[model samples]
Each structure stands twice: as C-alpha cells, then as structure tokens.
Target chain A: MDSEYKKEDFLLLFGSRIDIIRRKKGYSYERIAQGCNIDGSDISKISKGRVNITLSSILELSKGLDIHPKELFDFEIEA
Target chain B: MDSEYKKEDFLLLFGSRIDIIRRKKGYSYERIAQGCNIDGSDISKISKGRVNITLSSILELSKGLDIHPKELFDFEIEA
Candidate 1:
C-alpha cells in the first residue's frame, strides 16, 4: 500500500535525526547503543542511512541522549 | 558526507508526514501540489519515498495543509 512508502520515509527521517543528536551529544555509536539498549551496529547503519529503526528505539535513543524526540526533526537541511 | 545521509533521512521523514496529512485532509497529490506550488509529480515521488525534497518545499506544503510543520514528525511509526 501507499502507506507503506510513507512509513519508510518517516523511519528514514527519524533515523537521521537520531544520528545528528548522537553526534551533537558527543556520544559514539557504542555509547548510544549501550545506553539505549539498541545494537551498536544498527546504530551505525541507521546513522549512515543504511537501516530503518523502530519508534521504540527512537524513544530509547532520546532518553539516552536527553533530547526531546521532536528535536530530532526540528532542524531542516537546505537541500 | 555523513551529514548528507542525515539530511536525506530528514527529507524522507518530512515527506512521509506530508503524505499522511494530505490523506487525512482528503486532498489529492495534484491538489496539494497546486496549492503548495510544487510539482505534482515531485509530490508523488516524495510521498512514495523515491525523491528527497528541500526544507522550503516542506514549509510550503505545511502552509498549504494548514498543519504545523512540526506535526509531520510528531507521530512515530512502529517500525
């Protein structure tokens, strides 16, 4: 369904924000993964836009990074 | 650059939100495109996760939809 496409898009966006916040917080992939209970390799892949992550993982990452989940999408790229 | 991947992820997430809001508002792709001054085909591609859009386009789409730009990233997909 078309909705599936939309879901994928959302995941990609959310994943990117997670990567930005991680770097901004000065946390490495392993640190974030250990803190968030997610796989470090998956974090690396997600940061590189090679993997899609779940909403639960996003929440965990948010908690780990001390950022509001919404802040991830707050800044926009110029394109 | 890694930043490029993050940017792409943001665009994808923003685009997905546009698609969800458009459907919720009962608007067609063409209608949103016409109102937002973006190419309809681009809207279609963006919605389908095939195209990356600029932040300006996201703002225009938000204006056309009467939805807060932040709302697009408000809801998280289950993954």
Candidate 2:
C-alpha cells in the first residue's frame, strides 16, 4: 500500500521503474527525448528521482517509450 | 500509446480514474482527505481535471485510497 511510503520514495521508485523500462526497450535518453517534449538531460534527472514530475510529464514519458501510461506505474511497492 | 493524447487529456483521464476508484471504494472527498494531506475541495478539482498535480499528490491520493499508485492509472486510452 502507498501508506507505507513517503512521496519521495514513490518518486524514486517510479524513476527507477522508468529507467528499467527504457533500458529494457534499448532506448537512450536522446531516443526518448526525440519522442517527447522532455529533454534527455531531464530524463536522466527524472530517472535519478530528481524531478517531481507532473501527470503531463508522465504521459510524455509514456509517449517517449511508446507504451501505455499505466505501465510507468507498474513497479512494486515493497512493504 | 500515449502519443495519441495530449497532456491535458491524460490529466483529465487520470482525474476521472481517481473519481471512479473513489466512488468504487465508497470514499467521499472528505473521507479521502482524512487519509491524506489534500483538502476535499482540491480533490474535487483534481477529479474535474483542473489540477496538474505533481508526483507527491499522486502518492497522497494513493495513500488516501489505500491502493497501489499503479491502480490509479489503470484506465484504457481509447484511440
């Protein structure tokens, strides 16, 4: 449950999840950037949990990955 | 793919998804507010697609709903 985690924790986890997914698809930050409005540097920062990105950014990331937006939230929240 | 939609569209969809989930759980705005930092009125605005909420807010909403954050994003994007 999300109750067990702080907001930053979830952001960090979501970032890593994005990292994993992008890597799995063999996408470079530039590659992802080419597909969306986000810059490659921003994507790097996001993957490191440095960005408190909004829902629109999430949608852009999903577009960059060519995946469903829900997939970005697919990582597990450990207890 | 998220490429089919704009940022506002995703926000609206995400908002509606939250509305659906809260209704399914029989959680009113006040009920959810009691579980998180968000005010009931803000939740209403968020549900109406009027807020471009950050990652932290999403976490709080998930906590309020006692659900995984991914569940908040489980709706389909129609073409």
Candidate 3:
C-alpha cells in the first residue's frame, strides 16, 4: 500500500463494497477465489483492503462473484 | 498514485485495458464522462492510471461503459 493511501481510504472502501457484493451474491471468499484461480487468502486480503488488486484480478473476481467490477465501488464511505 | 504502484505497472496495464474496452464498445472518454457525470480530465487520468479512482466512480464508469468492471482488468500488460 502507498503511504499516501491511507488504509482507511481505499481498503475499507473497497472491502465494504466487496463485502456487500459477496453477500448479495451469496459467495464465500474461498469459493470465489477458487473459481477465479486466485488464493483465498488474497481474496480475504482484498475484501479487507489489505491488498491492492490488479485489473486482471478484479475482472476474475467479478466473474467469480457474478457482479460487474464497477459494483465493487457502488457504496460510498465518508472520509 | 501509490509510490509502490509504478506508473508503468498499473497505469500502463489499466490504460491498455481501458483502451481495449473503450475501443470494443466504441466509447470516447467524453461520452463516458458525460454519462458517468465525472470530469473528462478525471476520466482521462483514470484511463492512463494517473489517478486512483474511488470505487463509486468505478461503478459509475462501468454503468456508462456498459461493461462489467471486471472486463476493465481482462487484459494483461507486461510489467
């Protein structure tokens, strides 16, 4: 993560969005990661905003989650 | 952008992906920005990976582009 990028900024925001989408789709991180051929720990990290994902991973996760990657940013969190 | 995120890495990668998607859908940045209600400059920055966008903007752009956000990351660029 960039020192300029507060963990609270992108991570929490990204995590919350991922959480909402995952719940809406009824998918576990493990299941989604498996389908996307990525590690479950990585997915967990992503959902928690601990990792910054590549565009490719984002696409794979979307496919696994059955959501538009844009939905990952649908919710707003106050800074 | 994160110092950890090399401009050449994410920017080029994201840019190429966006370029591919935009071309595939025949969308100009102006049209997408207008549809998404974001600044055209901002959209240009994003396509070039010069700025790190919020999840909300990502969602909006996806809607405007008529693409699953995941498709934005479908292309791979060599680091």
Candidate 4:
C-alpha cells in the first residue's frame, strides 16, 4: 500500500499524546499504573514509544485516569 | 475505576467492527493481508478476537482498505 503513515511515526505520536494527557491530569506514571493494575515500567515503555500497547491496556489507562477511551485516542495528525 | 466496559466486551466489539468493515469494503482477510504485508492468519485472529492487534496494524488495515484510520476506529457502541 502507498501509505505515508509509518509505524514508528504513529507510535511516537501516540506516546506523546498519552504523555500530554497524563501531565494534563496531574497523574504520574506510577500512580496511573497502580490504578490501572499495570506495571509502571510498561506504562513508561508506552510513553517512551519503546513498546507496543494492547487495546485493553489503552482502555485500562483511560479507566484509571477516569477519562473516556475516545479521549485517549483523540489526537491531531500532521502527517 | 467504575468501568462498565469489560476487556472481553471491547475486544469482541472491536473484532466485530473490523469484520463488518472488511465485508463492507468487499475485501477478504487474505487480500487485505497481502496488500498490507500482514499475515492472513493474524487478520483472522484479530477478527476472531483471539489476539490483540497493534495500532499500526489497525492503520495498515485502513491503508489496505483505502480508508482513513479513524474509520477503522469508528463503531456504534451499544453497551
């Protein structure tokens, strides 16, 4: 497929978006991780774009943050 | 977290949505997999809710189907 969206590009953008959301809510990675029943390191990895996160993890993060799942997915794309 | 959204429920809904999109686009798993350079078995697994697919994969599917990424993420929630 003639696609312009690279995997790493999307991952980085997604990570940055999550980080922004986390900061906006004043929630640390550890706190969010504990609330979501996920490891802090995994959350860190996701924020660092070092690992691929599952859909369950994404929704769990939203649940932990007391936000809607769609909010987690809301991001502006420049690419 | 008071999430009425269960992990299994979302996965099933997601898989079903993807399946519906595939059918609506008139594209088979094999054809889509071939177009996106993904394995047909993996596509089947995603559609069957037997595996967790990455965000990149979901985007690649949209690319393969000649649609937007947001469209892949779109679904009418009945829960």
Off by over 4 Å in 1: A1-69, A72-79, B1-13, B77-79
> Can you write out model 4's per-residue Cα lDDT over A1-79, one digit (the tens) per residue?
3477787877787788789899999988898876676777788888877766777887687776777556665665554
* Alpha-carbon lDDT, every model: 0.60, 0.89, 0.64, 0.74
List residue ranges in candidate 3 displaced over 4 A. A1-7, A77-79, B1-79
Clashing pairs in 1: A13-B9
Q: Candidate 1 on A10-49: residue-level lDDT in tens?
A: 4466567777778778998888766566678887777665
Per-residue alpha-carbon lDDT of candidate 1 for residues B1-79, written as tens digits (9 for 90 to 100):
1111243454466567778888899988878766666777877887766654543455556555665446756755332
Model 4: fraction of the reference interface contacts it also forms: 0.40
Distance from true position, residue A11, model 4, in Å?
1.1
Model 2, range A1-79, lDDT digits (tens) per residue?
A: 6465887888898899999999999999999999999999999999999899998898889889998878888988875
* Chain A TM-score of each candidate structure, as shown: 0.66, 0.93, 0.78, 0.85
Model 2, stretches more than 4 Å misplaced?
Answer: A2-4, B2-4
Clash pairs (backbone) in predicted model 4 = none
**Stretches of candidate 4 exceeding 4 Å from the true structure:** A1-4, A76-79, B1-4, B76-79
**Worst lDDT window (10 residues) for model 1 chain B?**
B1-10
lDDT of 4 by residue, B2-71 (tens): 5567778777777887798889989898888866857888888888777777777766776677665556
Instruction: Pick the winner on TM-score between candidates 1 and 2.
Output: 2
Which numbered prediction scores highest in lDDT against the true structure?
A: 2
Global lDDT for candidate 4?
0.74
The DockQ value obtained for model 4 is 0.44
